[model samples]
Target: MRRVSEANGLRIWVDGDLRDEATRVDAVARFQTLLGILRAWRSEAGELRDEQRAGLGEGPVCDEAGNQFLSIGPVRTYTTFGGEIEWFAECTRRGVGMSQHLRNALWLNGRLNRTAADFYMIHEYAGVEFGGSLGIRDKLKLSTNSQGRLTRAANNLSPLEGGRHAKQSGEAGMTLDEQRTYVADLLRRWINLHSAA
Candidate 1:
């Protein structure tokens, strides 16, 4: 079989040697089966995307120890979102660069929130080096393509982003919170598998 084209965000493949009517019919049947599977997957992924997006807008979530974090707040100079320059100045005054400050903040957030410290540290460092959350995502998305699946299904999937930048670089692209979520998800799945066993 060979991939022919991308049909409606899904890869369409054509089977080899369609000289006979039986072979043609079988190929059509297989294509239809694949279409059904794709449709089902699309539906499920759509639902999951909705849920994930909704979760993103949620209020400050508390950790297992009832410690709240992950929200922007007022600072002496400005609000959390507006205090970028002020924060930079403060960090500089404290003999810490912006990158180091971000690492410290992310690490503190991770520890207080009972999250993955290493993932947050890496993600924040990458974000500082790049630009913003989108930059982090662009850099970390490469992890998904490590195996290099040349299919629309893999391309259109979550975390893939299907952008040209994802191809330009091979960095571990992920946002700080996304990295923590990814780490937690891995541990969760591992526990589930182990618990069932």
Candidate 2:
């Protein structure tokens, strides 16, 4: 697939919920709960994976017929979405920088008292690196590409006075969208083909 170089003003997006969706639909408390669940699952899932891989001893997780439906399929579908979104929530945010990412969410009174976080974190180093330099624009873009790709929403709202997305370099190109479709399709195919067994 074609990738835009850093030279291209960077229209990159994760296509994850590629989300950041109806901030009005979620609550910060829920995001906190979601984070906890993911943490537990990650530990459990890793154990199962390690057990499966240990047997393979540097081989593929397949036999001559095809793949293991009992093992890989369900685990992956659940684990991936589970882990990645957690990674976003946990890893990619921080500090005074953190509050600013979801600045508009304060104005929103979600029915459920929850809102998708404004920024998705991939790293949580200093406040400025991910939250400041990369900022809201880039977080949504990266979030949209990662776990956000799986979600189905279009709440990239950045139009009010303070509602502005933090300024980061949003990419310029079609790669993010194209790759999202292709990979989503591939994952669907892989699951259908294997799970049927």
Candidate 3:
């Protein structure tokens, strides 16, 4: 049996049979990575509370018992676009009707900004599902390389912003809001296509 305990706002799993030191270290590393991903999602959702911020303190994260933990800081709110209540309701309805995996992919895509890392993550999560024999790109009339070009452009912008790679010398050819719209449309079409299949 595995015993779970919470510390520094993270769940630590203690397994009795797992005695390998390297495996235990790897499991902790993976758990930390997963925690970071969840924290990023929570930040994107703008759900961080003041108390949580206070608990994080000014330096590295430490529990009340003075046990030092991962260097993760408190999530800060970003300027995310807010839509109408009715539109949000419609989106929620559509998401609720989809399969769990598809819904998660779409949700993560929607929460992302117009950064190269965001584009790459989106592609990794939803692209394969819609690509290949599914013909989603063709149905949307997107060029064979449209997704790739967008991802490259986002990654290769000049004077790199937001800690993403910027080795090229041009813009993404679309504004942030435009990119958001395009991704939203793509996800909507995917949902429609999958539902009909």
User: All models: lDDT?
Assistant: 0.37, 0.30, 0.48
Worst lDDT run of 10 residues, candidate 3, spans 39-48
Candidate 1 lDDT, 16-120, residue by residue in tens: 676878778766654443332222222112122223433443446688999977654322221236644334323322332223433243223223222233333
Error of 3 at 45 (Å): 13
Candidate achieving higher TM-score, 1 or 2 = 1
| Clashes per candidate, residues 3 or more apart or on different chains | 5, 29, 0
Candidate 2 per-residue C-alpha lDDT over 1-197 given as tens digits, one digit per residue, 9 for 90 to 100: 12245663212223334246644234443444333223222322212333345432432456678964333322343424554643432332222134432322212211121112221121121124335424422532334343333122112322221112443223322232332233323222222222333
The candidate, 2 or 3, that scores higher on TM-score is 3
Candidate 2: minimum summed lDDT over ten consecutive residues — where?
106-115
Better candidate number, 1 or 3, judged by TM-score: 3
Query: Which is the leading candidate under lDDT?
Result: 3
Q: Using TM-score, give the best candidate's number.
A: 3
